[model samples]
Target chain A: MARINSAAQLEKVRKDIVLKKDPNKPCIAICGGIGCLGGREDLIRAFEKEIKKQKLEGKVDVRVTGCHGFCAQGPNIVIYPEEICYTKVKPEDAQQIISETVVGKTIVDRLVYIDPNTGEKAVHQSEIPFYKKQVRNILGMNPKIDPKSIDDYLAIGGYSSLAKALLEMKPQEVLEEVKKANLRGRGGGGFPAGLKWETARNAPAELKYVICNGHEGEPGAYMDRAIFQGNPHLIIEGLIIGGYAIGAKQGFIYTRHDMPRLRENIDIALEAAREHGFIGNDILGSGFDFDIEVHLDVGIFVSGEASALMRSIEGKAPEPRPKYTRTAVKGIWERPSNLNNVETWANVPQIIGKGADWYLGIGSEGSKGTKMISLSGNIVNSGVVEVPFGTSLKEIVYDIGGGIPNGKKLKAIHFGAAMGGSLPAELIDTPLDFDVMSKLGAAIGAGGLFVMDEDTSMVEMNRFFLEFLADESCGKCVPCREGIRQMLRILTRMSMGKGKEGDIEALEELCEVGSLASLCALGKTTSSPIYSSLRYFRNEYEASIEDKGCTV
Target chain B: MSDILLTIDGKEVRAKEGMTVLNAAQSSGIFIPTLCHHEKLEPYGGCRICTVEVESRGRTNYVASCLYPVEKNLVVRTRSEKIDKIRKVLIELLLAHAPDSPQLLEMAKEYGAKSVRFGKEPSFCVLCGLCVRYCAEVKKKNAIAFVDQGPKREINFIPEIASKECWNCKECFPLCPTSYLQAAYVLTQGLVGFKNS
Candidate 1:
């Protein structure tokens, strides 16, 4: 394979790859994401052996792709052209899936997703309620391509956005388009990405840096992992474009060390991208040079914080510095740096490929793009779901989520993992907007939504979140280290049926002090769970104190 | 470099452009209490003791004076009712961990923070990272550092370095607000001997 020297050469390669492939060809895309591969290696092997046994080489394509999002019903497989969706597939079912779905074009009744409320079996991918309501702009490619193959990405018009950005538009023009799109960082804070880039570009530094926050230390969130493992080139393309836009020659992807597959996929994608000239020196012959290095988190939650992440990258303990100056202005060895979330970076290519108005027309007034949420806990169909902003929480929990399992009533929904607060079931009408959620004392966070049923105790939930926050706090600040310790102590005693008169007031006072005096977001938002729990469920605390146990 | 004029507690003061609020206040004879902050070391901002309300560019926020750089026209309130309340809570929290530290106890007394609302454990180390920073920055030894995280976070001397290098130097011992580092030094020396034997 020759390196692409110019944008025309890259476009020619994409055209050549696309012309060789037939859209109507039969292709089996098996879900190879971490969630779906739970002892399902044999399932993939079965498909390979069965295809060879049937002598269907080149006639049928068996590709192992990333997570299909409906993780509760995985290992999942989708047959292209007809778009036959199969769920909860096993090794024995692989042969039948090939014969019945791929060759015969007959849909298997049991493998299709059956709507829990309607008892309707949805054969195609678009018919199911879970996939119907989602507007999967970024995640839509996961089922269509194999992560290990660069050609699969190119055939789908992958690096065309980078080529377009480098060849057609100036750096300032690209930044202006992103600003018009109103894309916010999906990694908790939702800061405007365009503003961050403009600051880094204008900062007085000869060498600037761009970092992708893939640490994703939030307990239940796997959206970053899915995107990183499934579509590594998308992130790579976005990073290269970002480096070009910010005048940065170097970039880094700081992900968690625990996920080995995600790291391997990203490495392969980077090598392939460099070989294709989408990365490395003289990208697309536009006189732009950029490269990316992948770094792993050091098993700490606060490392996801921007300042702390920069410190970690600098070989120091991952503790956040005081934000007297924004990190974009002075960061990463005192050079200008731009750090955006994995999802925020992934949205860049779409905003560039299609115009900003096309991207803006999809979402609500303020937030103008789809958000990929990792829905887990009490829901029936737990996986990742990408919905446009302004979609109600009730619709997410019911229409797309297939409602709570075991016919149990949902009591509350916990958003933003430990840092975010919980909203009672009655407030499910709240739009999934960043501002709206923050107004209700809850945060959309990094797209982790944990549903709780009737049997779940709010008091124990509060204790669980406090324990997580206390364990993850950097111990750098007083309000975080000492304050969280005292709050946990009081909550523990209260949970153990050891009631006291002044405990509630003490907890409230501690919340105010911790929120006000803490140094970083990790310490500041630690009180959110406690404050919201007390706000909505004060009766639970009162009952625990008066009755010496939980009331519900 | 040009100096910036700012108001600290309603008194006009002039400070260097890069000077922190704590440095400006101290140079101007206005007092703001702090722990885990040393003039020679980089500001850690871990202990929120010197937090003050600052109104800058139409927005008011409480920031640690040790790390917040001085700006022209900045309005800084070093002592106030709300500031005092937050400081008392911070002192009370610190008191629970380091009840025997004379410096902490004196600060608590000065701030009228009489009682430890969350109970006490009688610990001597307040996790101020003074000894850790001193070893890394001034001594340039890098012998002792923090390990673990959250409430379980603690400091320990690197066994190899402590045995090979730190035994000859006691520079960080007197820097601890409490006498905890002195005891740690004795214990570490004994452990080194045991390991060598």
Candidate 2:
């Protein structure tokens, strides 16, 4: 396909791309995500080989897509058109799927998802309880598009939003839609994206920048990787539209250094987009010149912070600068730079294509649009689930997460790991809004929900966070570095049967110093592990002091 | 730059636009304590001992005066009961690493910080980055710099450069808050075996 020079040409190309494709055609989408890759059965090659063995070339399309978000059952495959969801798919099962399901049009009863609680099998992916409550507006496109193919993305009206933004809507109008929609940052902080874009737009700078924060350094968080790797074009499209809106001639995707496949997919998507004129000079004949470059991070957790991320992009050390003036106004070489998470970037096209009111129609009152959460740690389901805002924590833990395994009761649910707080099972009723969760001492931080079972000790959990954070911290501020070290020593002694009388008071003093006097957010909120744990489960710490036993 | 008026410690002070609150406070007589801050270097906000309570737009926030740019009508309190308590804890946290440093001892006395509270881990270096920043910024000799990260972080002299540069010019020696900088330089010189070239 040649470069689409105008909006009419883009529509024509989309029509041609959609004209040749058949929706009824059988497409085998294998979960090739980081979670399920080289899984229990290497099913990608197996399905390909089985398709060839049956000599169904054009009749069947075996596409390796991104994660389907049902990773508890390894090597998931979704047979399309019919949307027949198969869980725990094995290499040998490929032959039967090709022979029975693809050819004979029969349902494979054994591979279907069975609700463990109800003991009932479901044929379609949507019927599973794990997916029933989810509002998968962003990740739902993963199963349909092969990351390497631009046509797959275009078939779903992918760049049509960019077209609408470029052809018809003014930059101000696009900004207005986003501001009215109130789309919050998905990579934590939950600040409105439109406000940042508006700041970058209005700032008195001839040279401005927009960055996609794909350096998902949050532990157990892979939703950014899922949406970005599975569908890079969608995110690139979002970046292009953002650049057009923010009047930034240059854009960047600041992604992680690890995950070579994710990087490879992004490269392919960028090349395909540049070839198709969605990027590069005079995009789609709108005379709006903008291009994007991909930058790799230093692979530290704090490099994901906005200021630290900007400094890292400047080829400097990944130490966070004070953000008294927000990064939107002065960032990335001291220019107005608008940076949003990859997940937040992915939400832009939807808002631009379907108006702000349409986008705001979903989710809660405060937060608009959907959030993708990566479930991990003792949870039964333990996969990526995208649900709208205001979904209660109890619903997410039980319905979507499948609760804790081994018949053990839940002790607490932790969010944002070292920087985020933990809430006991009693407060799991709190909804997944930014203000609501943070008001309860828990945050919807980058949407990583880690569940702890009844046998787990909160005292030991605090020690674990401190131990990990004591090293991962940037070591710039006196309060954070020395404070975490002192707290870790106290928690270790308390866990190792050597608790002192004033250890709790010392920890509290350290927490006060950390919260009040640290330089960055990482320094300030580093005491969250102690804050929420002591708030909800102080008895565990008191018991550890009294019993003088290793809680672990 | 135009003069911007803001109240520091309940007194109206006129500060230049784009000037940090630390400099503005220093222009007046209001004292804000800082350890890693230096006039010749960029404000690092690392030690955070210069934290002051700034109330503006109905929000009270503790910000490092060394880096926070002075805003119009910013109500800055250089010292308060809460600020004293916070400074006491901060000094105590730093004193655990270098209890014998006279500079830290002076501040500890002022803030009522007890060195024995955290029980002395004793690395001696407070990681002020004074020698590092001074060497890099003022002397134009990148001899000593910060290495590693987190609690393992420390300032070390570049033996290759320090051996060539430091014997004639020991400008950073007086800037050390503790004896750790001298000790680290001696150790690095021993490792390099007295480069004469």
Candidate 3:
């Protein structure tokens, strides 16, 4: 195992690790994301026992990876090389995963993920309509290995990416490659990765830092937490790589304290990285000293903002400052710092391992790489799914999400958490890329894709968003403070059909003012959901105002 | 830190980096109505009441100042006729939803919310991200969060089937505007105590 330092070395290591058939051995990867932890716990053990019973323990490897993203297909089991995905697997089906797929190299027709609309049994994850068009850059590692086993990741050439980066490419080159990939921050705001790194690199402070925003505050979103839990090391690796690239000696992962499991696993993974010399004051022995510390959240939604989050990390109350410097130039104790979300960091090793050209080849123009989405709410198969950028909302809900449960019709789709906008039933066919969603008045926020059914009330929906905004507005500014108070009142009135003749017009006006007067991203993006709702579902507001009641 | 001068509602004020437009107004003794906006939780930008008119780069744009970062040469309008009208409607809606609560009713009246046009119905937590954000940010114990999607979304106490993830710290209850938290606590406490008794 040679310590790799650069892309040239990575290219060589990749060739050396190109997967080929052992013929005598087979591999199985299971879904270890929290969504599957409970129901699939026993099944995983059963799978282990069945493998042993069949005397294939040494020859066949069974590992668990993080969220496969298609949570609806939980108790997910995928066979290697062939990429055959078995969905809704129960304890009874464990034998089939081991015997049929492991031994005979055959697909289990009944256990395969079935497309609800086409009624087709999806065997290979790629062939499945939900996955076929997906690029899966951020979530690429989920399907290939288990989160619990480093060796499973190793066998699939996981650390090889890091090894190559350390041994072959220079830090500057690695950053440039990432820039060429055109990777944007997938944690809601599409900030460029290279720009942050360059700013940090050139900043005037000596104690530079890199922070991982694992504080997934969006409603109905869990991509960051799932990735952190599923493949803690991958993120750690990315963090270390980011630290090295930006010349930072320290890094921090700001995760909510509520997710004890994620915190615990990340600690364990950090220890593992330290043991491997991947973290803690040195390289594979390259003398590039970089380390990471976990900072549990102190309970402020707005604190996820770079400056506010930095304030909390310093053991201060999480509060916002209006004229704060960029986190890249003056963050984390007023030093030059770079912040990327869990998903952003996860893509580093891959880009460094495989050339930037290879990474750039996937995804639509401007938005490259795969996005892991937690598809939940109202949908029949509420699960996690990782797809390439540009996949449509219809494909995610129908093809991967298995449509709404009980045969309910979809009313609208909400993207980018609570602050994001909702699309009407007519736009269900819309593609779910960054540009497309922004044009539709929605954004791919934090990777939480929640489906809504016909029973959902749009007025209530907008009001719900308002309620979140009002409480989380930090009260540092009048527009956000007073504006949210007023908006919440109006939305509540509208939802209850107490809206006056000018209520809708009033709301539209407030939407404008709130957008203009607010002081941070929280206020700036507040009207996003409201405007989105108004754009698609004006009738709901009209009903609340004109009809003096909710239609639903 | 260097300070930049900006005007909010014709009041020229100086602010530092990391301060929001809302903070500048409040410091200047200008009060704005708010609902879900809490100082402790992360900004959700879910509510639109905190909106204002911002003139920047020779153009005017509407933004929520709570979540928006203030910049140099930015002019902000905290209140306008358009903003007030919307605020009144929002109050009316809150009154209708939680008509039983005197607090909401008074706010509605202040905003000139006349009446709820429809019959009253049962209510829940106002869907403010307080509990959810608190669980994630303050307690660092995100046992409960906003679960489900769309208008029917709720503050789920442990998504994908309930578990003991909730320490029942009662942090979310105090922050809930609609008293849904109080109701849930009472019901849950009663059920548990009854079983034990």
How many residue pairs collide in each prediction?
0, 0, 108
What docking class should model 3 receive? incorrect
Write one digit per residue (lDDT tens) for candidate 2, span A125-151: 889999999999999999998999999
TM-score of candidate 2 against the unseen true structure:
0.97
* Tens digits of lDDT, candidate 1, A90-203: 899978888888888898888888887788989888998999999999888999889998999999999989999999999999999998899899999888999999999999
Off-target runs (Cα >4 Å) in candidate 1 are A546-548, B163-169, B180-197
- Among the numbered candidates, top lDDT falls to 2
Q: List residue ranges in candidate 2 displaced over 4 A.
A: A38-41, A546-552, B180-197
Could you tell which candidate, 1 or 3, scores higher by DockQ? Answer: 1
TM, chain A, every candidate: 0.98, 0.97, 0.87
Name the lDDT of candidate 2: 0.88
CA shift of B15, model 1, Å? 0.8
- Candidate 3 chain A: worst 10 consecutive residues by lDDT? A1-10
TM-score of each: 0.97, 0.97, 0.72
Candidate 3 RMSD to the correct structure: 9.4
User: Relative to the true structure, how large is the alpha-carbon lDDT of every model?
Assistant: 0.87, 0.88, 0.73
Candidate number with the higher lDDT (1 or 3): 1
Candidate 3 C-alpha lDDT tens digits along A255-314: 888777777788877776676566765576567888889898876688787777888888
